[model samples]
Structures are given as structure tokens and as C-alpha cells.
Target: MITDPELDGEWDTAERAEPAEPLAPRERAAAAAARPWLWALGGVVVASAVWAGGLYALGDRLAAPTVAYRATKNLCADFKAQSLSGITGDLRKRPVNKEVSHPAVDAAACVMNNVPDSPGDFYVYVNTELHKKADPATEFDVPSVDDLANVGDLRTEEVPDLGERAVMTSWAGEQGLNLKVLDGGAVFNLRVFATTFSEKGGRPATDSNAVQAAMVQDVRELMAALRK
Candidate 1:
């Protein structure tokens, strides 16, 4: 390598500076004025990108379920006190069932119980889950119903002419009845857990045929209520 030996081998000497010509007064004013306009143009470009991206984000949110939709549906709000009194069979003395909205599932549940604190015996629990699909409102049976079927006691099958789709499940020992009805884009489930307790701390068996007929009629009435 050829070496330069200027001032004891200092190779990268700084270049001499050219004197900057000072701007005229009018030119300085024009340059200052242009900076704000340049910043404003950049702001507009950023805002346009944000606005377009927001619309695409809104489209994604539109597919998610909303609590307002479930709370205002037929089951939650349509039935008056007198109507529920009939369906629940003289539980009218009970306070009005409050609408409970579940935002996560985009669903809601309205319940009335003979005993307020008790989840057992003589309660009507109506649950609704909304979906985008038109068919197959529900994919699986309620866990209790499936348990009975697994043990050879419950029969779960699609019952035509009930609604858009429905399943009737009845337990062999007849301790409880679970009926699921799928109407339109919502899946509605009615669970009735009613059993008389014998003096010996054992649950008395119910009339299986009577319970089945009554559950069938409940679904029928639910369909009628939705129509109204």
C-alpha cells in the first residue's frame, strides 16, 4: 500500500469549508412558510392511511356477536309477565326474571325458579346462543343429556316440525328433561330439573311419558311466542 506522509502520516485531513451564502430576507420568510405546508401534507397522508385501515378493522368487528342483539331478541324481551306466568305454571308470584346478557358468547339467559337461591327442582332456564350459520344451531347435546345417553337412559334425536331444528331428550328414570330448539340463527335450550324428594332422601321417579309430552309442549309454546 502506498502511504501518504503529510504531517506525520495523518491521512484523513478535513476538507476546507466553503462559505455559505446567507439567504435574502424575502427568501428566508418563504422557506419558513413552506415548512408548515410540508408538515401539513405529511399529516394528511398519515390520516388517510389511518382512515382506510379503520374501515377494514370495522368490517372485522361486524362479524362478532353483540349483546344488544341478544338482549332484544324474542326470548329476552317479547314475553310479558302474564305470558311467562302461563308457561311457568303459576310462578307468577316470583319476581320478574331479569335478562342476563353474556357478551363473550353473544348470548343471554333468562331464568325463573320456584326457589330463588336454589338451582335445583322446579326452575325454568332459557339459554340462547347466536351464530352466523343458518343450520346446525347446536352441535352437541347438553352434557347431562349426553351422560344419560352414554349410560343408556336418555334418547336424543332430531324432532322435525318443532322449529327450524330441535332435539327432544328424556331421561329413562325421569329425573330431568332437557330440550334444545334451534330457531333462525339462534340456538335456544330449555332445561327443567324437577323432581319430588321422598321422605327417605331419595328422589321419586316421575312419569316419563307425561314429562316427555310436557317438554314437547314447552317447545311448541316457545315457537308460538317467537311468532308473536
Candidate 2:
């Protein structure tokens, strides 16, 4: 108590302090160089996420079905008198399937009927073709639909209050009717070509105004099916 280590004079301040270590030039430079690369890598990762988000948002338009089983079945159901031979769907995304007789179709089908001298089944074509708005160059530029009434010498009429807009057409050249409906970004086309082939060559059956009337009714029913 009397000495008290001379009021703490024995405390060694020099022994408690340690010298600061200076980094080598090479190590300092390496750390400094890595900062820019790290920032760039983070930016790249963020950009990739943004791109993927855009694709996700546009998934339906990009991945829209080229053909579908349920779609074909519903279309075929619209026609009751004809015998359905078979149905098929094209699921390809690019370079759409083209046909000389009709606009490029996403699906194909064959139908048969009780027409004498017909060597083979006729056709029941369904196309969920791209709309004029979607591909303005070729979608609605269908030669068959555009000119069949005039070229085939068929009866034609505008169908009122049908699917955005619709047309009912009968082909005297083929003896069947076509109902073309334009809706949104797609054109729903249903056509039947009923021709008989014999020694006289391919010839259309007798014209019937009844067929054209029936097709218009069928198209209305088909619109209901599509809604469901």
C-alpha cells in the first residue's frame, strides 16, 4: 500500500504496441484488380435474370400450340353427317406446314361421305392458322380462301355476329363449304372438300344450297366449343 508500484510506473506501454504490417505491392495490386471483375460478374448475373423474366412473360405467344388433340376433336365434332377417317396434329414451331390447296394448316384430317364413284376419302381440314395481325405477310393471304368463291364459282356470304368476323363459302368446284372465322391472333378455318374421282377424273358433286346453310350453323356451334 505504501509503494503501490510507484503509481503504476511498471506498466510497459512499448511492449503492448505492435507494428502495422504493410502489404506487398503485388498483393495490393491483385486485390485492386479483382474489384472491377467482381462488379462486372454481378451485373452479368442480373442481366441474365432479367432476360429470363421476359421469356417467361411471353411464354404463351412463343410456346403456342401448333396442333392439339382436343382442338382437332372439337373441330371434327362440328360436322355430323360426314364420316371422319382420321385426325393428325403438327406440333412444329417454325416453318409452318404448307398445303397447295389451303393456307398453311397446323392440322390435317380426312373425312368420307356417301358419294358414289369417290375412289377415296375427302377432306375435313382444320387450321388454327396465324391471324393477319400476327403474320400480316402470309397468314390471311390465303389464295384458297381469298379466291375460292370466285375461282370455284361458289356461293359466298358474310356471317354476321360470328367470332370477331366470319365468312361462309361454298365451293361448286369441290361440292363442300368452308367457314372461316377470324378471332384475335388466330384464324379458325374449317373446310370440307368433297369431290368424287372416277374414270371421268376428279369432278365436284351437284351444288346444294343446303350445304352452305348447314355450314353456317355448324360454325356457330364450333364457336361454342372453342369457348369451353
Q: Per-residue CA lDDT of candidate 1, range 1-228, in tens?
A: 676667466665478578989999999999999999999999999999999899988774455432212333535343333432333344333533444445344455666654554443455666666554223333544454445554767767787787677786656355556778766556667666565423222334345455556666765665455542
Per-model C-alpha RMSD: 16.1, 17.4
Span of 10 residues, lowest total lDDT, candidate 2: 86-95
lDDT of 1: 0.56
The segments of candidate 1 whose C-alpha lies over 4 angstroms from its true place after superposition are 1-89, 95-105, 115-121, 133-153, 197-206
lDDT digits (tens) for residues 1-228 of candidate 2: 445655877654656567868779998899899999999999999999999999998776654333311234433344342212211111111112232223433333323333333343344555544432233223443547445546747666778886666777765554666778765444666675655323223433333344445555655665555552
lDDT of 1 at 133: 28
RMSD of 1: 16.1
- Model 1 TM-score? 0.47
Quote each prediction's TM-score: 0.47, 0.40
| lDDT scores of the candidates, listed in order | 0.56, 0.50
Residue 196 error, candidate 1, Å: 2.4
